[model samples]
Target: MVTAAIGLEFVKQFLNLNNPPEFVFACCRDPATATDLKEIVKSNSSVIIVELDVTKQESVEKAKSHVASIVGTKGLNLLINNSGLINSQRIGDVTREDMLKCYEVNAIGPLMVAQAFLPLLRQAAGQQSSEPMSCSKAAIINISSGVASITENSSGGMYPSRASKAALNMITSNLSLDLKTDGILCTAINPGWVKTEMGGPNALITTEESVEGIMSVLEKLKGEEDSGRFYHGVKGQTIPW
Candidate 1:
């Protein structure tokens, strides 16, 4: 599932693939206001607009039910927790509310969504014939950031964003272990410094570049060996988490 901006680009890229998925659920906080996403999928029947608010448990559960009704026994192949929040507050300026809100959106949201939709993912895994774990069968990919890496924290800022994302990385690792027996792969990926609204125009790469590299890395992920690792979106290399 996804939101607008970078998430919208991912939806577009998936549709453009040579052999696209049977269904592309373009999830957002408010589907009515998601004009861009609507426009992109206007002519396509495969893309379904799902109203989802990552920060709200009710919204997440509702979206899960909606998706379950559609996919039915076939199940969902992949779950992408691409929703995120970034606060500009630094160490001295950040408040409890700031940290809580950031944690709610960036870390807890994905965890709730994963918990709700895990049945479908496990169903998909059981149905697929592939012996090795793969995205085509079942996977949970959390969109993380390099700033979450304690070893790579040379610039020390974005206190809320960093801490919450670090929590998300830990969540990803825990899921990887917990879901391994179920034949599900879980990984945290840093989509580089993409030129999105959050990444800013001064960022090193474009959304297309980031998404492209992300797709490449995901395509190569296989079995237990590749799961529970943090990856660099553009470079397709493991990040220091």
Candidate 2:
């Protein structure tokens, strides 16, 4: 899991699971600065805070190495690309810097992280003899947004955020196909208009509500049957690309 507003909720929910993960790497750009994240997981020995900057390849590789060292032959089972950046600028106000930065963080970052962690994901998948593709074996979940849906777009604005997230949706689809042979499932999930710094206080749902819905959808994901799909986290409904 990654550490952010919604990412923190995921960590909490995962911890509360009846059968919690053996270890949850609460990754963030700077562990030293993530006071809230640190405080919540301090008492739990299983939650390990990792320093990871998704936008930087060096940082991604470093985090991968650290995780690989710890997980050893067991390898990693699940990777949630929960890191994101939002640029709310409209077409007239959006700049090249805004567009590029959002694209780098929201679209390219997940791809880079997945590339760096492919060996571990493959290692975990290879360990599963003839078992079906599942998160327990290996899976990549990209946290996307509903605004990325081109088909569902009614009001047009937020050029950077919309475009970058749309690109992310495409990346998720490609990853699903590319990693299918390795039995790795990849999917993009829209956590809905949650009440977070990004989502704003006027958002439709709470972080708990959004994560609960996301967890429900994730729990039901199956092999190729569910791969490469865009989902509404709150409703568990498919969204058009």
Candidate 3:
């Protein structure tokens, strides 16, 4: 389950390639409103576009039910809370409404998605796999940001984006502990300054590079001990939370 999935480069690259997961959900706020990914979806039979509005409780509940109906008792292997928003710090760019909006989408949204889809993740734990409860455990990847780090915030600005992502980091830590017994390895990952709609053209890397690096880390996520750590997906290193 890829929450707020369609526009992201990670989702785009993942869908384009024939990867490990047999079926992938291209979750978006509005499927009809998503102008991107049309080309990617047309060729990829495995990609399933799901309507999901993370900010709303009712919508999340409905999405969870719909996913449950499809996966049934077999369960979902991975849940990536990739939905987020950023309000720039540039002059006249930030506002009271935008600040609240940032919190709604970036921080609370991931938590809500996790809460809604937890049952299916537990179902995955019940099934047998090579690692079982080892490195290859069921996972929840939260797309966090480096701007969230207070200690490293030398350039300090964009309080809405920064503070919200910081809150998201905390949520990720809490989830790691909360879901530990269920064998779900929940971790927050910063995809780095990638060249995307949000990252802008001057960003250091591309989405494919970021996703590839992230997948490598995810492919070997050890159980409880590995949870809660902040990772730089592109750099393949741990970031201070």
Whole-model Cα lDDT of every candidate shown, in order = 0.93, 0.91, 0.78
Best by lDDT: 1
Q: Candidate 1: lDDT over CA atoms?
A: 0.93
Each candidate structure's TM-score, on Cα atoms with residue i matched to residue i, is: 0.98, 0.97, 0.89
Candidate 2 positional error at 18, Å: 0.6
Off by over 4 Å in 3: 3-8, 12-19, 90-95, 129-136
Error of 3 at 27 (Å): 0.6
Residue lDDT tens for model 2, 144-200: 998899999999998999999999999999999999999998999999998999888
Error of 3 at 161 (Å): 0.6
Residues 5-73, candidate 3, lDDT per residue (tens digit)? Answer: 323565666555554456677788777867665566787776777888989999899888888888798
- Report model 1's TM-score to 2 decimal places: 0.98
Q: Least accurate stretch of 10 residues (summed lDDT) in model 3?
A: 128-137
Worst 10 residues of 1 by lDDT: 1-10
Off by over 4 Å in 1: none
